[model samples]
Every structure is written in structure tokens, then in C-alpha cells.
Target: MALDVQRNWDVCMAENLERVTKESDQPKDKKDARETTRAEKPKIWKSEPVYLPDEIIIQILEYVSRFHESQYTLASCCLLSRQWYSAAVPMLYASPYLYGKNFDPFQAVMIPSRNLHVRDSPLASLVKILDLRGLVHQASRRITARLLGRTKGNLEAFIAPQASFGTNSFAALAKCHQLRILDLSLVSESPPLFELLKTVSRLDNLTTFRLPRSSGFSTDVNPALITWPRRLENLALSGGIDAHFMHGIVALPSTLRSLTIEHCPSAKGFALMHMLRAAVRPLAHLETLKLANLPRLSGSACDNVLFILPGLTRLSISVDYITPALFDFDVSSHREAIECHYPTLPHAESLPTRHQWTDGKQCELRTLELTNSGNPGVEDKVSPIDIVIALDEGALPNLRQVRVDKTLLWQASATAADVDALADALKEAAVQRGEDESTSTGVWTF
Candidate 1:
């Protein structure tokens, strides 16, 4: 009976081992499916996007466009959707900051194909400012002309390239009636003065015009024939304009507000003074005058500036052309000479009568900027004490701000007291004028 029980137990143990082996050999995927089936899985809900109004999107984009590096962000936004592209494209092309690497693609888009029949690019009209001053050899005359032709409809400001702009570009320039600022200061070779003036005369909307630094006002054209834009307000003259052309301008527009003269290799003190007396001073609205980098002017050449332009409110001149005597209250001789000619001056209707002139004291000058134009030993030309004495003497009653270059060393320990005195004087002046601290009169150095 014990032997029979042992055999039965062995047989049962073999069967149990076989059953466990079969269970283990079954496919693993089926077991996993069974285990997963026992648990509940979460359902994914597909929802529609919230619609935003076009006006709201545009307002958001306008806020983003205020960043300095917003061009890249705007370009990225163009790829989002049709609404985004339409809103971002105008802001992206309105003021394209062109450089060497990206100029080719810009030109391609501006002038899509060589063949004229190809549809004109709708992107062309969106450009408002086409500044090519950064490009050196990337553009040609033909390309500049074509670009101008494409963008002339709404081009408000154009900064010509250094080498590519020429007379060929004038035809398209004449058609840019909407152009407001034309800056050719970086141009290496100026186009013909006659053609340029003639082309620009038609732009009634032009307000600011800067002549090229390389402009050689050769005597081929008569200065009398040069007609300035009627609405021109700001004019910067540079380059090789000689005394004859400088003094021969028939009449500066009455709308001129600011005048800048610099880098004139041929300008002399007498010629400039004559031009100011004859052409510039008569303007009723002339307020700001800037002179710098004039090679021929002496240290005292501009001493009588405050005496000449009695109505001028702002003056920016290099220390190389001025002295402390600029603020002298005794302009008896200058007054006598100017009084003799004031009646005969053009635009006499606008000139304050001889009695209206300040009695040898200029009180209208509000801001003065003294720069260093490569002059040695210029630190001692004008000092803080000089300005303080002038203020005490009541020469510059309305003088609000004075800016000096670092070369003057006004910040040195030797002049610390003088600098403080100047600041205090300005603060007192500001208080007298009832101005707040933010707009207070002060001496600032750069």
C-alpha cells in the first residue's frame, strides 16, 4: 500500500511540472493583452482652435514690432497662417534693414524677374524706407533704379548706396513724390548737381535733403537756376562747394528750420558768413544751425554767430571755430553793419525791424553743442567759468543746455569746482524759468 501511494505522488508531480511549462511557453503578447484589457484607458478629446478677430491680432503684432530685433520674430510669424502672414508682411518690409548677405534675396523679391512683362511684385508697394547705405558692391546702378521704380509709390525715406547711385537713378527719384527724406551722405560720387536739383525740385513733399559728402559743385551750373524744394525744412551742405556757389544761392526757402554745414574742404569764414547773411538769416523759421569739420575756419571765426543770427535758438559748432568772446554783449559794430543792411535784406517782411534787435545782448540761444574736430590744444579754448561769467553778465539769459566733447576734459579735478558752479547756475536758471528737473538747464559732457 505505501509503494502504490509513492507512484501516484510521482505521477501527479510530473503532471503539475508539465502544466507549469505549458503556461510559461504561451505567447507573451496574449498575456499582455489580457492584462491591459482588465484596466481602463483614457480617451483623447480633439478640440477646435479658438478664433481671434483680425483687429486683435493686428494690435498684438503692432506691439511686438516695437522691439529692436522684432524683424526675425515677424518673419517667423509670417509662416503661421494666411491671417498672420498678411499682418506681418507689411511691418517686415516697411523698413527693411538691408546688409550684404541678405541684399540679394531682397533684390530678387523687389525685382522678381529680368523680363518686364512678369507681374509686378505686390510686396514692392509695402516698402517705405529703402536704405542701401550699408551695401558697398552688392548693388549696381541698374538695380538701384529698378528698386526705386518699384518702390516709388510709398517710399518715404531713401538712403542711397555708396557707389551704386548715379544720375540714372534720378528718373525714378523724380517720381517718388511721397519721399520725405533723401539722404545721400554716404554716396562716394555725387550725381550731377543740376540733374539732382532738377529732379528733386518736383518732390514737393520732400522735407529733409542731405547732399553727398563727395559733391563737387563744379561751376558748370548756375546757382541761381537751382530751385530748392518749396517745402524743404532741413538742409545739410558738405563736400567741395566753393565760395561762389555758397554765396550764390538765390534764396533759401522760408520753410527751412535746420541747417547743417560740415566737411566743406573749400568753405572759408567770410564765404560762410556771407551765405548766412544773404541766404540763411532771412528765413523766418530758421532755428537751428550746425557747423563742424570746417578746415578753413579759425578759432575766432564763429565768435559773431550769436551776434549774426539773433533769432537762432540752437547752435552746434566745433571748439576749433569759437572762443569765449562769442558771448560778448558788445555787438555795437555788428549791430551797426547789420542795421544798415537789414532793410535791403530779402524777405524783409519777416525780419524784425532794427529796433526789434536785442540791444547788444542775445537771449534766444537755448542749446549749445561744442564738439572737437581734430584740433590740438582745444581744451583751453572755452571753459565753464567763461559760461558762468556770460550768464552773470546776462548775455545768455535763456541758455538751457551746453554739451561739450570729452576732449575738453571738463570732468578733470582741476575744473570740478567750475563744473559744479555751472550746474548750479543752470539749476537756478531752470528754476527761474519754472521748468521741472527733468527739463532743467544743465552742462552735460559727451
Candidate 2:
């Protein structure tokens, strides 16, 4: 090594000496011109390579991951160098948005071989969200199960495809202990309710769970056999859950904070009321409730919901199932019936009467959302004036927001004055509560 270095140094000196000798042999004008040209040339400064700690690099990558178009940037970063590849590969695979064209490629990478021991990619373990809701004909049940098996180690959220998910997928799903959100609402052919609930019972970290719209709990689900995740906070129930199943759910987990029931074809008004009184009223931590699209519900089915769930802070109900009497106190048969059912209930006496209800104190409801269930004449069932009158009578004193659908014709000139009154009432309520004036507290139509 030393000899080779000495030889190269001698060769460089000889070349420099030859160049100098030639330059000295040149005319003074030529040498001066060469020197001036060299002086006019630009100089480049080389900077030292910067080194960042791994934690700082990871934080920056996380921020980039928040952008919707960050996947391309992250993919490019993976080829920079070993250090950059190590940092970017995980973020790139953490949450992949699979569409039709890319589904095959993604599956090939995740399941390189049918034999598990022969091929397994570390990238599968980096995935925290495996959303296959976009693919329809591109994947099959077996492939979906294999993909889940590959990602179950770290997967936190799974949105099943609309048609391909089946009983085979549940085995891998049960192993995903880190799952937080499971949305199977789009499944056309849902797996049996018994197997789904059994698999979900082991997910200790699950928080949000939505049942498929095709869920048919025909006979397998026993009320006493049902068990939910320990920390479940939000739940949605839909489809084929008839009066029998509705009444069978005697208890929901106490940790529940939000509950949504929609698109039930067989749920009658009386059965839902029974469930609310017997099962839902005992949940002390519940806050938000949404009910919509029940074809079997009567026009006056949900009028007594406010009386039954007095502790709810947010309620979204279809105007088809309610009337102006929804906000008006029914100290008659409805009130007596609720009291008759739960004689020891604490909020039984506080079911406000038209003459005695205090402003904002009688009702804890803060937001009311009105939706249409495609029923004719629903546009006139509940109006802006009706809500304004409710506010005037101090029915919902804490109500700050009222959202209506455009199908309700709330923006028509006939109801313009009433809408104005509703807005002013909301603003006044916000001000009385010492809330910001710029807060979105008024009526909104969609």
C-alpha cells in the first residue's frame, strides 16, 4: 500500500512539473490570458454530510405520513441509502390504500408463496392498517385470509372488502390483537354473527366496531353468550337484527360512549323502545346515539327517545320516526309508560312537563340532527318553526346545533323567518353559556 501511494505521488509531481514547464515556455500574453480565464471561473464549496438522530428522522417521516400524497414521497425515500431505506420502508407500508390495479401486486408481495415458511416479507409486519374496502373482484376469501395472516402481527385497523370477506377471514382476524377499528359495514354477504362476535371478543384493544349491513342473527346468537371487547367505545348495529334479537341484547358493555343503529328491516318501534329502556339506559358512559333508515318504524316511533335517554348529549334521528312532539314534553301516556317500565329509574321524575321544565336544565341534549328516511311528506313532518318553538318552550336549552337535510326544504322562503329565529336562538344559547360567538352553533343543511 505504501509503495503504491509513493508511485502515484511521484507520477502526479511529474505531470505538474511538465505542465509548469510548458506554461513557462508560453508567451507572457498567453500565460496572462490563461490566468485571467482561470480567475474568472466559479469555485464550488463542498459541505460536510449532515447526520440526524434516528428519533428525529422518524418524527419527520411521521409528519410526512400525515399528507394524503405522502406515499409517493415515502417510496422514493426508500431507495436513497441503507439508513434512509430502513427509516422510510416502515412508513411506506404502515397503511397501504389498495385499489384494483395494485391489489394483485400487493398480494404478491405479502404472500410471496403459499407455503408460509418458504416466503414471508418483513414489510407485512410493518402494516398497521390493511384497508381492502376498494377491491371487489380482484381478491378472494382465501387470499384475504392469507393477507390478514401476514399482517395480523401489527395490524390496527381493517376495513373488509364489500364482497370477498367470509368465514375464512375470521381466523386470521382473531389473531390481530392490536386492531382498534373494524368496519365491515360494506360486506354484502356477512359472516355469521356468532363467529364474528366470538372472534371479536378476544380483541382487548378494539374501540370502534361496525356490524355489516347484511348481518342476520337468525338463531345462533344467545343474549347471555354475547361478549364485547373490554374497551369498546363506539358500536354500530344494522341489518336483519329483528325484534327478537333487539330484545335479546339485554346489556351492552358499560364502556360504550357512542351507539348507532341503522338500516334495520325488522326493528319495530316497540322492540327498539324496549331495548333502549332495558339494555341501553344502564350504560352510564354513553353520550351519542344515532338512529336512521328503519323502514319498519312508525311515524311516532321515536317521539319518546328523549324521555328514555335523558343523559344523551347528542342524538341523530330521522324526522320520519319523530314529530314536533319529540321536543315537547308528553306528561301523558308516554311519560307514564316510561315510568311504569322503570319505576326506580333516577331520571324518571325529571321527564319535563310543558309547564315546569327549566331552561337548559331539564334536557342535557346539546346537538340534534334531523335526517330523512325516504318517506313521502317527511319534508313537512318537522320544520324550523317547530324547533324554534321547542327552544321557546325551553325543551332543549343546551341545544347548540341543528343539522337538517336539504330534502327537508328548510331553506325555502316560507321557512326563512323561522330559520333566522333558530339561528338567533342558537347564538343566544352559545352566548349564555359563555361560548365563542364564532363557534359553529347555528343551523346547517346538507
Candidate 3:
């Protein structure tokens, strides 16, 4: 009985017409009383079909195609006219989402009798995003490679299938000049590191790339650091990445903007710190830094590098890795070592709550996401309170928002006291900033 506007429009119109027909056949007594009925509504009629330009119509259908969940309505639009077919077909083919139920039929259309007939179809050229992540054991690897071969020219963002994407697809993937985002994070059996690097390095236009989980890969594999793709801006490495790859990384490309290192067990405290200073610090454009689930990272190693990041804007680090010293406004030992190199003031006391480098550029930090990443409350660690104390003291002057896992952090009694201290710090910080706490909304209670 539930009516969907997109799917049931014609049916609803027919039902309305039928009701009007039924009303005309009513008895004289009923007709006299019928003005009170809901069916007595007036209609706004137009004699000619509305003349919508092709461009406007296509634009309207494009929005419909993206906003609607089910494609039944889109498929119906294609049957309306040749003009509609041309407009809706491209939108439909732009991102063909295939799952277990439709996988076989889609496979047949893409590769009929093992021959790719994609070129014969206009719809195939419009394919841009082929998200095969949902496909698990639905088709063979050969079928996937065939589709990639057909769509390689125009494909932009491809998240490979979890199970079936393999070596055969590499040739087609490398040839995709328009390729930008390549995410193989869910790949079950990772291809050899040497081959993966060689294959991906050929993609000149690739921007956002995520390496496969290291667990599915061989530990013996040592991939030599080569010239990474010129356009790569974001890189995420996970799954117990081998130390050789981490240590071998001389420096990320200057174009690199964001770097994420998570669940990397081999890269310990000093190892990670060394990697950051050597490989990461060289990138002038690096803005976002995320380190999490790094168990072996000592608090001191994290303390050494974070403050010196030239362009860090968003930092999400595990609470376990960072220490209270990070919030300290004046530490003479570090000042003498680090400050002397910069042309700026030698004393930490001269550093602004909102930091500016010697170049006179304001620090870009806007959001800080401090998380435990599931480490239990422990002694000799920086908690939420320490951060509030720092903020109140005018550290991280441009800091606007902070995110932490409240549920996990508040489970134990020992940490609960720290939460109280955090509350006091936040209140005091708010007061120090001359904020009208009573009027300002969105303040979290616990």
C-alpha cells in the first residue's frame, strides 16, 4: 500500500482516473453528497506535452540517477524514448554496482562467449567507477580482467574485487590513463610487492592509492623504492608492512599532501620517527598526518617529531604514542636543540598559542583527533585532561575541535578521574578564551 513516487507514478495516475470513472457512476443521492469526498479535487490540465530541452532533461535525469537507490526507475526512463535512453544510459553505466545476484548477467554483457563486445555498446564507454568490492566468489578472475580491459580507457576510480582481482588485471589497470584512485585495501591475496609497485608506478595520473593488507602478502618480498606516481597525493599503508619498505622509503614525493601509517607493527618507536623525519618531513605540502594502532610506538618517539611538522593541519594520533610533554609550552632542552636551527625566537616562551613559523605563516592545525585505538587506560600516559590543559595554556592556538572515543575512555574508574580533570580543563579553557559557555551550544556533557 506504500506508494513510491518514482516507481508508482503511472499506476497512481491510473488509479486516480479509475476513481473519477467510479464517481461518475454513483447514484443520484450519493452524487448530491459527494462534494465532501476526497475524490472531488480539481485538476490542473495542459493540452500539449511540456517541451523540455534535451540538456535540461538530461541534467534532471542525472540527478535522479544519482539520488535514487534502485535503478528500476532509471531503466524505465530509458524505455520512454531514444533521447531518454541516451541520457539515462550514461548515468546508469557511470558506476555499475554489481553484487552476487546480478554478477552473472553483468558478466555476460561485458564478456559474451569470452569475447569483449564492450566497444560495440555506447554504454560501456561511459563506465568510470567500477566498484567490485561487494563481489566475493561471484565470478572468475579472467572475467574481471576482461571488464578492466574493456573499460581501461575511461575508468577513473577502481576499488578491486576482494577475492578475484589478480595478476591478469595488472596490464589493463596500468593502461588506464584516466585512473586517479586505486584502492585495493580489501584484497584477500595481495600481489607481490615488486609487481604491485611496478604496475602502479606506470599510472601517471593516479592520486589516491591504498596498499593491500600486509597479512595477505609475503614477508620475504622486498620491493625496491622507485619513483612513485607523480600525481599521488594521499597514501595509506597498513597490514604489518615490512620494515624494509618503511626504512627503504627515502622520501615521499613533494606533491604528497596526506600520509597515514596504521597497524604497522614492524615500524617501532624510533623506526617510525626515523621514517617520518627522513621520508615524510621533506614533503612541503604535507598537511594531514594520522598514526594509529601503532603498538610499539614509544611515547617519546611521537613527542620528538609532531611539533615540527611544517604544514600539519589535521592530526589523529593514538593517545598511547604521545606524551604530556607535547603540551608543554616551555621545554629548554628541546628549545636549545630545535629552536636554534630556525631563524625564529630561541625561547619556547616566545611561541604563540597559535603557532607561526619563522616564515610568518600561521600554523594550519584545525582538528585534532586523539584516540586510544583500543588500548586500555594505563599509567604514565597522556589522557584527555592533558590536552585541555594545553589548550587552556594557549597551545595549539588555532585548534577548533577535538575528537576522542568517549565510550572506551570512560569504562574504568582510574580513567574516570582523568575525565573529571578534563572537564575542569575544558571549562577553564573556555572561560580563558572569553567564550560565553551558557550561549555556545554543542558542548559535550561527559
Candidate 2 residue-wise lDDT at 404: 90
- After superposition, the stretches of candidate 3 with alpha carbons farther than 4 Å from their true spots are 1-49, 68-70, 117-120, 215-224, 298-301, 329-363, 378-383, 409-446
What's the CA RMSD of model 3 in angstroms? 11.3
For 1-446, candidate 3 gives per-residue lDDT tens digits of: 44566559888889999998998888978787665564667676768767778899887887787764736677788898888887787787788778899888776666555555523444556889988998889967888888888788799999988888888989988888999999888888877766887799999999998887753335465444456899899998877665666666666778998888887666677567657766787688898998887777765567754455635878887767777776553434355325433448755677443234324544456567766666666333766667667766666555555666564444367766766665555555556668754443112322
Candidate 2 local lDDT, 1-446, one digit each (tens):
99999999999999999998998999999889988999999978588668888888889899998998898889888887778889999999999878999899899999999988888987899999999888888999999999999999999999999989999988899999999999999999998887898899999999999999999887756876889999999999998888888788868999999999998898898889888888888898999999999999999999888877777899999999998888866566476545656467578556656344222337789889999889999889988888888887877888999999888899999998889899998888788889985777899988
Model 2 CA deviation exceeding 4 Å by range: 1-59, 339-361
Give the 10-residue window scoring lowest on summed lDDT in candidate 1: 353-362
The worst-scoring run of ten residues by lDDT in candidate 3 lies at 437-446
Residue range 1-446, candidate 1, lDDT tens digits: 99999999999999999998987898999867877986656666689767788898889889988887888989998998899899999999999889999999999999997665676888999999999988999999999999999999999999999999999999999999999999999999998777888899999999999999888887777899989899999999988878989778789889999999999989998888878878887787999999999999888888877777878899999989989978874635355346444656554345554345654444588888889899899989999999999888878888889888888899999998998898888778778878774564788899
TM-scores for all candidates: the values are 0.84, 0.83, 0.74
The clash count for each model shown is 0, 0, 1
Scored by lDDT, model 3 comes in at 0.71
Give the number of the best model, judged by TM-score: 1
Predicted candidate 2, C-alpha RMSD? 10.1
Model 2, poorest ten-residue lDDT window? 352-361
Candidate 3 matches the true fold with a TM-score of 0.74
- Candidate 1 clashing pairs? none
By lDDT: ranked, best first: 2, 1, 3
